[model samples]
Target: MGQSEATVGRWSEATIWLHWLGALLILSALMVGWSAEHLAARDDQPLLFEIHFSIGLLALAVMLARIACRFFQARPDRSQVPPLARFAASTVHLLLYLATFGVLLSGLINFLFLGPVRVFGFVTVPQLFDPEADEWLRALSWYAHVYGWWALTALVLLHAAAAFFHHFVRRDRTLRDFLPGRR
Candidate 1:
């Protein structure tokens, strides 16, 4: 199927699997981060931070590959949606991608400068930037990461809502567009 028609066609199995896997990983990272923040106040913040940071790195790697695949694949055109709806959908997706990367980068930077980074008990990532580059940057990055989380959460909710609306309300192929071969 061609690009536009592909949207109405059954989604690739690869796409469906990767989409769900990425969703799980991203959600796990968010949950761990939120838990870490709450638990930090009571006990060892270091341990919680380590778990959160590690998960963030994993989520980052997964998202990078996911984004690459998305671009490589022919996505559905938003022109069919209402003008305002299309704009919102595009904006939400853009924000989700940006925030995913931002959170990953910021956390990695923090680990490199302020601490060490251990990824899934596998490899050790070296720090790219010197800690003394700018004190303000670290603070700014931390804030950005925090805000990015909130933004991602909102976008995810909206995305899910829209997909459901198409499935139940519009009675269209919107949900099917992202589902695996004919159910």
Candidate 2:
């Protein structure tokens, strides 16, 4: 039998936690990365870069867990949403995921090209390619990483706006569905 549509629903606790954790990590990483890029070349530049990289890696891990939870858990019922809204939400979500993974992977690739990096001050990640020889690959990844962040930032803003619209304008429980304590 088909499940009944919920007038109000909630995601699993794990999903809620992972969603917020991923958002926090992504925001922190982006800020750190932007700061590291714009600062004057200083002795501490490597440390700042490593911190950004660490945050990006952690965000990637949380995102993976969130994806797994999404697959295994029951999502909040969307029966009340208009078809167009559903389509737009799904499209934005898909693009957000793509941009996030792209940014994280491209950043890793760009970093690897620069040679070994002492991640978090202890672990040494050996360089995967010669920076001088594979400058083109590095450049490509660099561009992708930077542009991916911009795309992600836009998508995130759009996502939040949609949620607020559903909550305040539409006067629905859409926003509460993802809140930590909602049921």
Candidate 3:
């Protein structure tokens, strides 16, 4: 379909682009974080760290935009899905967005507590808080960051599974709305 025409219950071009790009960054950050220790030991570790940090920040920014767009734009008609399913979908989406923001903030705080770290080059991203931050804050933020990863993974899996369920089990357009092309 052409840009001029809107697909029913589907996302706009800008929203779709932001969603996919945010997804990519989130996935990349997770991969980097998983290998952080091993990667940090290397000479290029700082470089890798900066890349991960930058992407995480980018994802955070994109998510903020996503939330704003979600509220401002009209969603595709929910009349197609059962009322319960629609409610579930809305709830899941809200949780996903909140969880995503939490993960990003945890990382940011972790870095801030670590002290001023270079983003990717000699240029440094300023710490949001002073180094040697409170012990409790440090420990809590650390756990939050660690657990955030696991939570994010589980949430994404559930979201993906539900989308597939709608596509296969429900035989609905729920999942297709996010697809690049309308069938």
Candidate 4:
């Protein structure tokens, strides 16, 4: 949900903004997807799916930018953090990135296999993969998309819990390091 490191200075404003934007887009897609799940028998479900798909694509773009930023950015010194905690934080950060892309890619591939799904009932999604010929791959992507969502959800919760723990239990500024202008 936030940076894995506790910084001695503030993060770049762009990274901070992207972090919040990515969180909003991801959560919005999750809500829309959940609604579509519950409304499975309804006529408007496809509309929900279309909205979810659109948001997801946006999320993917934001995530890609964030990952690019990561490579060029220097992380805060972890000297103050316990080695185990630092390792765990880094692992969670990596998993969060992987799960995010995994979910998005699998969802996109699954739709391509199931297309031509209409976006907003006007624009038709092209069937890139022949569903009849790639039924097995379609099934695999479907499972990945569904299970990836669950995995991402769990990682988000863990990320948030770590932040809250730093704020409350540890009485540290680690959580504040994630806030904008909190240098």
Candidate 5:
């Protein structure tokens, strides 16, 4: 059955955990990235960049796991939601995923072309592209990463607003479905 037609009541525990974890990781990555870009002093920037890059990589992994879980696990049915609301939710979710992957991929390309990235001084993320010839690619990737982050941030806010609407205004189980022990 389609998401809007199914009658399932709650999301699986794994899905809920993944959703919350991914949210935390993404938020952390965004904060660090913003700091690296706008707040950190030039001397302190490299450390912040490394932290941001590491967090993004971790978020990418979690997102991939979440996608796999979505296919394997049951999701809360949207049958209680209006068709238009369901469509809007799906669109927002799809856009969020696209923006997330865009940011990760572009960041990876930029890092690869710029130089090797050291993650928390433990593991070194090797350079995948030569900087000399791939400067243009790096620049393109930088722009994509920046723009994708903005899009992701906007989408996240919209998503949160929708969730709040469902919880407070609609007075439905929509938000509760993903909350801990809500079933």
Candidate 6:
């Protein structure tokens, strides 16, 4: 009954929606962050920065809600997966959460120290620290934010690859667990 019960349940609707929403937000944030860094012209940079920052903040909120949902929701049982694979999957998921949170937090901290950012010309996000006085902190946060993005990108790739492996090679419901429908 234990094994049967574990295998029978599907992810909750809330979990599925959160999973897809978080993925979309994170991917969008990564692309916007990259564009702001390398593609935007000097004059257009502020707009791009505003979009990127806003998206990061949104991602942070989604991630926090996702974490909370994980605790309250009934996660689909993983007894179907091999122990080693289960461990690996759990590790990847944990790292994904950590990397995302790290990137968002560092970005917010950097912006707070260096900003009075005007978002899309509509609103100004006030600074937490004076840019001139907290230059050192700003630099540290900038480094963390940049490196955290890289780490998050790597983790995302790995996570996607693992899902594909489970779907194509293992032929399992692991990928389906987070996907909408397919109950």
Alpha-carbon runs more than 4 Å astray in model 2 = 1-8
Quick one: ranking by TM-score, best first?
5, 2, 6, 4, 3, 1
Query: What RMSD does model 3 have?
Result: 4.7
Per-residue lDDT of candidate 2, residues 79-106 (tens digit):
7778998898889999988998899889
TM-score winner: 5
What is the Cα-based lDDT of residue 45 in candidate 2?
Answer: 75
Q: In candidate 4, how many Å is residue 183 off? A: 4.2
lDDT of 3: 0.77
**Cα RMSD, model 2:** 3.4
Candidate RMSDs in Å, in order, are 3.6, 3.4, 4.7, 3.7, 2.7, 3.9
Candidate 3 lDDT over 13-61, as tens digits, reads 6677788888888999998877765656777676777878877888889
Candidate 6 or 2, higher lDDT: 2
User: Candidate 1: which stretches are off by over 4 Å?
Assistant: 1-11, 40-44, 77-84, 122-133, 181-183
lDDT for 67 in candidate 5 is 81
Against the reference, the lDDT scores of all candidates come to 0.72, 0.85, 0.77, 0.85, 0.84, 0.80
Reference-based TM-score of each model: 0.78, 0.89, 0.85, 0.88, 0.91, 0.89
Clashing pairs in 6: none
lDDT of 5 at 92: 96
TM-score of 6: 0.89
Ranking according to lDDT, highest score first: 2, 4, 5, 6, 3, 1
**Native-referenced Cα lDDT, model 1:** 0.72
